[model samples]
Target: MKSLKNHISLIIALFTVLASVQIYVAVDRTIAAYETRLKDDYSVIVVSNKAFVPSEFKSMSSMIERSEPISTAQVLDRLKGEMSQKNLDLLRLTLPKFYRIYLNRYPSPKEINNLQRLLQRNPAIERVEGFAQTHDTIYKLMLLFKNVVQVFSIAIAAVTSLLILKEMRLWQFQHAERMSIMALFGAPVWLRSAVLFRLAIVDAIIATIILCLAFYVIDYYGFLITQLKAVGISVQLFNFVNDSLRSLGIALGISVALTFMIVIFPNEED
Candidate 1:
């Protein structure tokens, strides 16, 4: 029952919802890819520097740090001192901060027995959990938060898109007669084709841009974006889409061409 012009907000809102869904998927995928690459590089770097760092550095560091919270300055100082006992590999590889210097030798039961005898006496050494113990639970929790936001964003976007689409269709029905009459008239093939192609293409381009910008605002501007850390996510997607703009151009061309063909060709008594 609504006029199309009267429902401009609904159309725009639909675009916003679609864009938000796209932005969440794109950004999460990008971040995951980035993290994977970084993890690989970090692992390689850590591995290469292992010889210079103490074999039991993680174990030993845990022992010492049990007495106090790890001060970055103190940790780095300790690392520097350990790096002084250089071998060939240690000399070549650079040690990075927070780069896990694995205790290459897993503690045998006999070694553990000895370590317990020597170290467990101190109240500061209350517990000696392996690095895996600390990293796993915390890492999973971080990952869970990251995924929850993305999922929540998608759900909200989907619901908004459906609502807006419903509102937009109410507006669109008002134009149905005009569209049917255009088909009824003997509109020239070239004119109809060009008009339809232009209309669809222009609308698609406008939609894409609006979608992209809405996504950015949803991510970056806190007021509009209720999702957590969504700005960072949106910005990342913008960068990705911007980088692959050629794809958009190609898509536009294909869409316009297809629309032109559909409009120009005779079908169903038009």
Candidate 2:
């Protein structure tokens, strides 16, 4: 039972580290998806003295994906009942050309400023509305979320790594007598440390398998998808092939490093 508990403890530690990293990955992807949606829906309105060409704006700023002219027909229709046909036609002809320009991706505050300045520099453009305030608020919030997740994941991984080392040390002590006896009998260090490496690899694989299976179940059930939909966004929470491989790699790496550390630096008494 004690041996089982030890194994379980190591597995749990490994699982916690893997879980923290996976959480960070999931949050980062979700934020990226949200940003993509925002980019697709967001646009800048430009008022120009002359008709605007999308190619002209694209040439001015690589960020500009395309532009569409805003129709003034509804405004003219609204005035038809009150004004004569000639007056309406004259007003339509004199109206400044309005265009909605889309960008390929969301821009940072500095980029927004640059785009506004670029548009305003054009002799034909009368005004550029980039919605700076709204964009800044959303951008800052997303950045804060990403930073928090990163810090949290790092903290968890650090603490769990210490726990993993402590567990390894305990295992080393438990096996010290056998190791010492082997050394006295002319057994090499690698041969004596083989059991520790085996244990490490076994526990790492177990932890990775558990993590992958848990996420696969969560993904299959669409729990994360439902939660995101409630918030009006969609994210790809997990890719079994990629994420599983990544988790396995991390687990094995940590296990191998800590095990090697313990084997290389045994207690001074040894």
Candidate 3:
């Protein structure tokens, strides 16, 4: 019974680390999707004395998805009754050409600045407005959110890893006398430490199974899905096949690596 309890405890610890990692992955994907949606609604306004073709900005073509000219008729409509037809004609002739530039994706602040500089370098462009203030605020908020998740995931993984390490040490101590006896015989180090390797592998598999089921339940019926829906960010909470394989790989890799380290470097008491 005590041995079973230890196994369960180790599995739970491993689950904590794996779940944290998977949660971070989901949050990152969701944020990236949200940023794409934001990009569709965001655009830069450019004013030029001469009309610009979409190809004029070809130097930065990778950053720019397309350019849309803002019609001068809209401005004329606003000042319709305020001016005579002759004055309107003169105003239209003097009014600068306006364009709205759309990007392929939301760019970082540095990228925005570089794009603005590139646009300004064009001889025809008089001014370019990238809405830097609003863009910076939103970008900073996204960075803060992602950083918080990263830090939280790291902390959880670190603490749980220590717990798993402690549990492994306890298991090693429990079988230390047997290992010593085997060592005194002709048994190799690998044979003497076979039990620890087996325990680590078994616990890693059990933890991965629990993690897969927990995420599956969360994906279908949890508040996380509802919350993301409310915010209009649609993303899969977990990818069953891909995520399961990744979690299993990470769990097995960490467990086996740690077990090997402990087995190879025994304490003075052992």
Cα TM-score per model: 0.41, 0.96, 0.92
After superposition, candidate 3 runs with Cα above 4 Å error: none
- lDDT for each candidate structure: 0.46, 0.90, 0.88
What C-alpha RMSD separates each model from the true structure? 12.7, 1.3, 1.9
On lDDT, who's better, 2 or 3?
A: 2
Model 2 ranges off by over 4 Å:
none
Report the C-alpha lDDT of model 3 over 198-240, residue by residue, as the tens digit: 9999999999999999999999785797897787778888999
Clash number for every model?
Answer: 1, 0, 0
Q: Between the candidate structures 1 and 2, which one is better when assessed by lDDT?
A: 2
Q: Score candidate 1 by lDDT.
A: 0.46
Model 1 clashing residue pairs (backbone): 219-231
Q: Which of candidates 1 and 3 reaches a greater lDDT?
A: 3
**Alpha-carbon lDDT of model 3:** 0.88
The model with the greatest TM-score is 2
